[model samples]
Target: MATRADRRETNPDLGVLAGQLLFAVQRELFGSLAELGFDDLHPRHGAVLAYLEVDGVRATDLSRMSGQHKQVIGTMIDELETLGYVERLPDPADRRAKLVCPTERGRAEMVAADKIMAAMQERHARRLGRDTYAAFKTAFMDVVENQRARDLSRRP
Candidate 1:
């Protein structure tokens, strides 16, 4: 009787490998970002920060971007505000709504995150040849785009 583990051992799941690699990259990126003295900034908070860097969005919009609830995004925003990484300004279009913007500190953090990512990329290219790494990146992006399109089609 071949058990599930036996099957997995004999023919490991490539999807699992991809997922594990993604997680490893995220962990390294987050850890490197955190070491720059940005306290309590988890992956979710980082996602919000990155999003806000591009646009000043409302909490509801941020909730959608972060894939979190409005209240959760609000809570994270409050913490980020206290940390001086983000600030809320009154929305001109909707006076009742507040727009979130990343502060100078937040921009600095973003730059640090970029540096970390670049370092990681260079390390990956050093380990795997540059051409191989570039090919892998292209294939990964293609899969990501396909998955995103599939997910959108599946949405009710």
Candidate 2:
């Protein structure tokens, strides 16, 4: 019998290894942030804060950008509100939709988190050597861009 894996063009072994490496990197990154008293944050919340940091966004827009379901995004928004990290504002353009904007406290938290993350990056760079680290970063960006391109291409 043919294996289901054979249906796909991509190599399953390489895909699994790539996912493992990505998860390992994320674990290290999240652990570093946890040391800075940000252990409460999840990956989804991070995506939301990063989105709001870039600009105020609607829940629908956040869902689209974060690749999260609207209901899940709503739950995240509820948690954020309770944490005093974000607030809902009446959308000036659309009466029915509320805009999600980060509060002052949220901005402060983001600043602190950024500092922690930057230090982590610097430490990793130091370990890898500056020049080698720079090359690695570029390669990582290339991989991300390529994956994004593939995703966009496959979208209907």
Q: Which one wins on lDDT?
A: 1
Please write out the lDDT profile of model 1 over residues 1-156, one tens digit for every residue: 988788777866767767778689778877877677865677767547756753478888887666677888888898889988889988889899888877888778878887888999999999999999999999988997787678668978
Clashing pairs in 1: none
TM-score: model 2 vs. ground truth: 0.69
- TM-scores for all candidates: the values are 0.74, 0.69
Candidate 1 lDDT (Cα, 0 to 1): 0.79
Could you tell me the C-alpha RMSD of candidate 1 in Å? 3.1
User: Pick by TM-score: which candidate is best?
Assistant: 1
Candidate 2: tens digits of C-alpha lDDT, residues 1-156: 557567343545646767776677567656766676667666667657756753468999888777777898899999989878899988889888788988887777678767766887898899999999999989987987788778878989
- Backbone clash count for every predicted candidate, in the order shown: 0, 0
| Model 2: lDDT of residue 101 | 83
Error of 1 at 86 (Å): 1.4
